[model samples]
Target chain A: METEKGKTFRYLREKREVSQDAKDRLREFNRAKKEILGALKEKDMTVNELGKKLDRPGHEIMFYLMTLVKYGSVEAGDIDDMDEYFSYKLKK
Target chain B: MSDEIRAASYDALVIGGGIAGGEAALDLANNGYKVLLVEKDLSIGGKMILLSKVFPTLDCAACITTPKVSEISRHPGITVFTGAEVTSIEKKGEREFETAVTKRPRYVVEEDCTACQLCEEVCPVVVHDEYQYRLVGRKAAFIPFSIASPRVAAIDIENCTLCGACEKACPPKCIDFTQETEKYIIKTGTVIVATGFKLFDPLKIPRYGYGVYKNVLTSMEMERQLAPTRPFNTILRPGDGKMPDRIAYVLCTGSRDDTIGNPVCSQICCMYSLKQAQLLMGALPMADVTIYYINIRSFGKGFEEFYEQAKGMGISFVKGKVGKITETETGNLILRYEDINENRVMEEEHDMVVLAVGVLPNTDPLSFFRNGELKADQFSFVDQAEVLSSPARTSVKGVFVAGTASGPMDIPDSILSAGAASSEAISYLKQ
Candidate 1:
């Protein structure tokens, strides 16, 4: 006989736990990483300029840039703003 | 590593692997009693190891917990089990009990698997990591963290695509596609409940804008920032990563609120928020930090001094309860609160806001005991016989409680409570 409700554990795992949003965002992150690396290889740019170039939020672009910076693939150069925000460049 | 369901016996069985459980196990082991330490999580250091530093003293938290974890693991008398849960426990004889425990498969063999993280690197599937509060990504095949005891990776079977990518990439070939859940019958003289607390999810209060606004963070999230192995380069606003000069902390987010059904005061939030505020003074000197609270609780020793120190450092303390948080167009947060001292409603805008989250008892599977269930109060914290003398004794004989398993407590209190539990268990065994 069928139960009153579907098994919660299985239901949550199949429906609630699986999110298409995460997979989409991960894909977008990969694309952004490639674009950021390509753009920086051409010329150094501030976070705002890169955001404008990519047509994305400055904050979103900075998140990707920070990961690269941590891995030594990207470097935050001299402070270029009153807020101590820096221009970033691909490490040569 | 053998999964044979053999009936084993021990002098003591510690039900958790957190600070309290670890302490109990070590105490019993040091006292010449064979002990079995079980943890439901992939690793056993518990929530304390995830934190940046301790309160009042500002000592590195990892420095204190790491040595204890390492010692517990190396102790000859303690048998450690991760990815395990106690299913049923029954009293068989005088001061002797039989416990049925089930061990979930980690997919990676602990004996053969090295913590190389190579399989993690190769695994194609990426998901939100809960250990990092879902702020980062983890592969399907992964360990809890770098310093995890046993340091073995587990497969998220729910998400595993069975692509065989991780299997092929393994140097030692520890990944097993076909693994079954293993159960064991453990007989022990005494049992200690030390399962810890879980943080209150702030999303419950939609007005606070935790999940809705990227700028709003939980105190646990902020702790990751102050940690030695920080989540980012420095403490920056999550919304735009522009260093936030103005930050506000909303104290008692989930506690003392009948609306959330948790009316008890979470004892640790007040001191931890103060600790973070002091840390921010050193981490970001120019930043202005303010804490909004219903009341400041400095009940523990030296806690009052710590609060005074933060106030002296010019960290603003407003005795107010925040009613709502609305995100500005520029990703800032405006906290609407009632300032009790001024006797007026006030609104303050800041670059970022942190919610001082509360804690709730987290008994795994909600309930563990069946026939002789230990009595718990309205808050789900195991009811203590007496707070002064019999702090560890439960209604069930040969069963004791420690750490947040019994109630909300600080680290020192948890350790003291663990000692009480160990002593009680020792006395029970002697009888």
Candidate 2:
């Protein structure tokens, strides 16, 4: 019952058909996810801290954090310092 | 449900899906009232969701908003109408009001469309990403933002090529460009207008050279840069991708300007500019941040403390009024303003400048009410029945106001106003 425009939009949105490109991106995404998990496995850190630890940008770390948070891989904790940042930790 | 059933069943309707609207709807729903939440945008998180952090508290804007948005979505007592607006409202049967709601096509079917975001990748059309405050580009067919409610994609049909590329690319074949605009009628016992406010366009003041100077950006744009999901990885000058080492914030860009007809001060700009300044320090550790202001009004709870904290953190506070801004050949902005304490004119160059734009009432109640039953004040904000005490009750019976729809205030006040609106509506229904 979806419209043709919507089907095409979703198809391109998922980008599932781009075999090589999709595989490469998926691999990169998994690599970032593994780095995040490994970093958090040792200590709870803020997004900025994790970004620094993993040699990634804060924005990019945030994207991964949201996904990890969504999938129960991470849990955001209390404000770190006077509300300037929120510390995050791996879910037990 | 059929049109007849959809038209006549709600205890209350909250217009807008911002923090205020979300709070009001949740409050009303918890009180056993069926509430219809209408949002003009495709998603419900509102402008606050697009922000990096809130003032004073510095809590993640998305962290606080997304939960309420999700609750509103899952609440049994609430119904959300996205991509819709109230066309008209009229009193019927003495206490009940009948409202006409018009909705634009989603292009992609909401229920069928999953927010895979791949549709955006395949689309050839590129446009200014308004969600990022035009700081970046987005595909014409896209979800509004990362945490968009329902996580569905909506097409910008006007700019869409309609070449059927999106249709062919979709997995569920959910891309439907054939949807038409629809209108429906709903009856509610009471109403809460949380229409929110729009930021004053910095382009209005030519001196700041907002649009003319590439490095002169608005505070919202800077906030976007600090946002977790930003277009750029680091703080960079918009003119070129070079990282800016020196940044200046010009406070009161649009507020308290008699020439611009916005004499009333925008209450939150000072604190927000400071917040962004503090955030810039975190984003670019080596960058020097300076704030030039005619006055620093830190009126809210813990705001003065937050101001002191910023100063302690090494942000330079200049007591002056910026007179003019001109760009150098190297794309640095030259600020000419009188330093009050020094009693002298000073010229400073910064790699980038941020204009702390003011907020203006975004809604005209008269447009939705022909009889002028629901009213607005001289400033065009919906008039509160009791400005000194009651923050929500409007001039008309069974109608209320909340958030920036009434006047300029911060997030906490907006949420409090929303609660007050809910209390008034719940009481009205009981009576």
Best DockQ goes to which candidate? Answer: 1
Clashing residue pairs in candidate 1 (N, C-alpha, C atoms within 3 angstroms): none
Candidate 1 lDDT by residue in tens digits, B180-283: 68889999999998988888999999999987888899999899888886656678776666677889999999999999989999999999999999898898
Please state the interface RMSD for every predicted structure, separated by commas: 8.9, 10.2
Which 10 residues in a row give candidate 2 chain A its minimum summed lDDT? A10-19
**Retained true contacts (fraction), each candidate:** 0.11, 0.13
- Choose the strongest candidate by TM-score: 1
Worst 10 residues of 2 chain B by lDDT: B1-10
Q: Give the TM-score of candidate 1.
A: 0.89
lDDT by residue (A1-92, candidate 2, tens digit) is: 33334444443334224345434544565688799999999988877688789988654676566556644668876654443356678988
DockQ of 1: 0.14
